[model samples]
Target: MSILLSVILPVFLVIGIGFLAAKRNAISPAGIDGIMRFSQGFAIPVLLFQAIANLDLREFDLRLVGTFYTGSFTCFLIGMLAAVYLFKREWEDAVAIGFIALFSNSLLLGLPITERAFGADATQANFAIIAVHSPFCYAVGITAMEIAKAHGHPPHTIPAKVLRAIFSNSLILGITAGLIVNLTGLPIPTVVDEGLSMLVRAALPSALFGLGGVIARYRIEGDLPTILFTLSLSLLLHPTLAWGLGTAMRLPDEAFRSVVVTAAMAPGANAYLFAAMYGRATRVAASCVLLGTALSILTAAAWLALLS
Candidate 1:
C-alpha cells in the first residue's frame, strides 16, 4: 500500500493530470505535442546525457544487461511469432507488434518509479540499461522491419537502413555523446552541467504529463486479443523472465530491483511510433500503449511488492 501510494501514485497522478487537461481541452493537442517535443527531444536527452556523462562505468554489470535484454528479446520474438501464427497478421505487422513488446517505458516510468521505490543512489543500474536502450531496440526493430519489408531485396541495404534509423534518433545522439564524454574524460563546464541539471529536473514530470496527453488521444480500438497479448508479454512475461534471470545470476539487490522494475514497465510510446513509422499495426500498437500503461499500475505495484 505504501509503495502504491508513495511510489506509484504520484507518478500516475502527473500523467492523469495531463490526461485530464487534454481531455478537457485545458491543453490543446498542439500544446501537448509541443510539451512532448520539449521533453522527449530536449529535456530527457539532457537528463540522460548528464547521467551517463557522470556515471561510474564500473557499476555496469554484464550479467544485469544480459538478463534485462534477454527478457526483452524473448518477449519480442514471442510477440512476433504469436502475431504471425495465431493472429495471422502480416509480416510487417508482426514485426511492429514485436517491437511493441520489445520497448519499455524505461525513462518516464522506470526511472521515477525505481527512484521513488528504492532511492536516488540505486538508479545507476537503470542508467546503464537506458544508455543502450534506444539504440539497441531501434537496431533490432528496424532491422527486423527492413527484413520483413525486403521480399527478396538485397540484404546489404538493410544494414544501412538499420544504422540510419538508429543514429538518426535524438536520444541516441545524446547517449553517443555521453559515451564519448565518459570514455574520453572530457570535462563539461560547471555552467553547462548546472543547466543540464535544471533540464533534468523537468524531464520526467513533463514527459509523464505529455505521455498522459498522448494516451488521451489513443482510443481503445478493436483487436482486443492482440492488445491483451502485448500486455501479457510486456507486463507479465518480460519481468518474470528478468526476475528469474537475475536470481539465477545472483545479481546484487540493487541490480535485481532495477532490472525487474524496468522490465515491468508498460510499452512506451515508441512502440506506437515504430508502428506509425512503418504504417503497420498502428491500431494494435496504440491500444497496447494505452491499455498496457493503465494495467501496469497494478502490475508494477505487484512486482515491487514481490521484490520487497
Candidate 2:
C-alpha cells in the first residue's frame, strides 16, 4: 500500500494530469507533440547517455540480462503464434502484435518505477538492460516482420534492414555514444556533463506526461481480444518468466527487482509505431498501448508489493 501511494500513484498522477489536459483541450496537440519530441528526442537520450556512460561495466550481469530478454522473447513468440493460430490474424499483423508484447516501456515506465521503488543508485541493472533494449527488440521485431512479409524470400537483407532501422533511432545513437565513452573512458567536459544532468532530470516526468497525452489520441475501439491477449503476454507472462528465472539464478535483490519491474511495464508507444511502420495491425497496437498502460498501474503495484 505504501508502495502504491508513494511510488506508483505519483507517477500515474502526472500521467493523469497530462491525459486530462489533452482531453480537455487545455494543451494543444502541437504542444503535446513538442513535449514528446523534447522528452523522447533530447532529454531521455541524455538521461540514458549519462546513466550508461557512468555505469560500472563490471556490474553488468549476464543472468540479469538473460532473465529479462528470455522473458521478452518468450512473450514475443507466444504473442505472435497465438495471434496467428488462435486469433486468425495475418502473418504481418501477428508480427506487429508480437512486437507490442516484446517492447515493454522500459524507459518511460521502468526507470521511474524502479527508481521510486528502490532508489536512484539502484538502477544500474536497469541501465544495463536498457543499453541493449532498443537494438535487441528492434532486431527481433524487424527480423520477424521482414520474414513475415518475405513469403520465403532469402533473409540475406534482413541484417542490414535491422541495422538501418535501429541505428536511425535517436535513443540508439545516445546509447552508442554512451558505450563509446564507457569503453574508452572518454572525458565529458564538466559543463557539458552538468548540462546533460539538467536534461536528465526532466526526462522521466516530461516523457510520462507526454506519453499520457499521446495515449489520449488512441481510441480503445477495436480488436479487444487481441489487445487483451497481448496485454497478458506483456503485463503477466513476461514478468512471470523473469521472476521465475531470476529466482532460479539467485539474482541479487536489486537485479531481480530491476528485471521484473522492467518486464512488468506495459507495451510502449513504440509498439504502435512498429505496427504503423509495417502498415499492419495499427489499430490493435494503438489500443494495446492505451489499455495496457491503464492496466499496468494495478499490475505494476502488485509486482512491487510481491517483490517487497
Candidate 3:
C-alpha cells in the first residue's frame, strides 16, 4: 500500500493533472507538442545516456534481453495476425493495429514508474529495455506498414529510411555515446555529467504530462470492440507473455519485475502517430492510446501490488 501510494499514485496524479490541463485547454496543443519534443530530443536522451554511461556492464544479461524481445516480438506477430484474421482488416490497417497492440509507452511511463516502484536498481534493467525497444518495434511495425503499402513490391527505400531514422534518433544517439564511453572507460566530465543530471531531472514529469496531453487530444475514434481488443493485447496479453518468458528464462527477481512493469505500459504515443502517418486505422490507434492509458492506472497498480 505504501508502495502504491508513493510510487504509483504520483505517476497517475501527474497524468491526471495533464489530462485535465489538456482537456480544459490549460495547455495548448502546440505547447504540449513542444514539451514532448523537448522530452524526446533532450531530456530523455540525456537521462538514457546518464543511465548507460554509469551502468555496471557486468550486470548486462543477454538472456533477459532475449526473453523480453522474444515476448515483445511474439506479441507483435500475434497482434498482426489477429488484426488480419479476426478483425478482417486490410493488411495495411492491420499493421497499424498490430503496432498499437504491442508498442508500450516504455520510456515516458515505464522508466519513471518502474524506478519509483522497484527502485534505482530496477532502472538498470529498464535501460536494457529502452536500448532495444525502439529499434525492434520500429523495424517490425514500420516494415509491416511498408510491405502492406507496397502491396508485394516492398519499397526499396525502407532499409535506408530505417537506418537513417535509427541513427538520427536522439535516444539511440545517447545510448550509443554512453555505450562507447562505458566501453572505452572514458571519464565523463563533472560539469557535463552534472548538466545532464540536471536535464534528466525534468524528464519524468514532462514526459507524463506530454503523454496525458496526447491522450486528451486524441479522442477514441474506432469500433469499440476492436479498440477494446487492442487494449487487452497491450495491457494484459503483452505483460503476461513477458512474465511467463521471464520466469522460464530465470531472470533475477529485480530484472523480471522490471521487465513485467515495462511490458505493462500503455500503448505508445508513436503508435498513434505511425497509424496516422500511414493513414490507415488511425481511430483504432488513437483509441488504444487514450483508453489504454486511462485503464493502466488501475492495471499498473495491480501489477505493482502483486509483484511487490
Best by lDDT: 1
lDDT, candidate 3, 1-308, per-residue tens: 68768987798888888889999999999999999999888998888888888888898999778877777777777777888899898898888888887689888888888988867766888888888887788878877777777756647888876677668778889888888888999998899888888899998889888888878877776488778887888888888888898988999998898889998989988889879877988988988888898898889988888787
Among these predictions, the greatest TM-score belongs to 1
TM-score of each: 0.99, 0.98, 0.94
Task: Give the runs in model 2 whose Cα sits over 4 Å from its true position.
Answer: 152-154
**Model 1 C-alpha lDDT per residue in residues 1-308, reported as the tens digit of each score:** 99999999999999999999999999999999999999999999888888898889976799999999999999999999999999999999999999999999999899999999999999999999999799889998999999899999999999988888888888988888888899999999999888889998998999999999999999899999999998899999999999999999999999999999999999999999999999999999999999998998999999999999
Local accuracy of candidate 2 as per-residue lDDT tens digits, 1-308:
88889998898899999999999999999999999999989998888888889999998899999999999999999999999999999999999999999999998889889999899888889999999899999999999999889877778988889899999999999999998999999999999999899999999899999998999999998789989989999999999999999999999999999999999999999999999998999999999999989998999999999999
**Any runs in candidate 1 off by more than 4 Å, and if so which?**
none
RMSD of 3: 1.6
lDDT, candidates in the order shown: 0.94, 0.93, 0.84
Candidate 1 positional error at 39, Å: 0.6
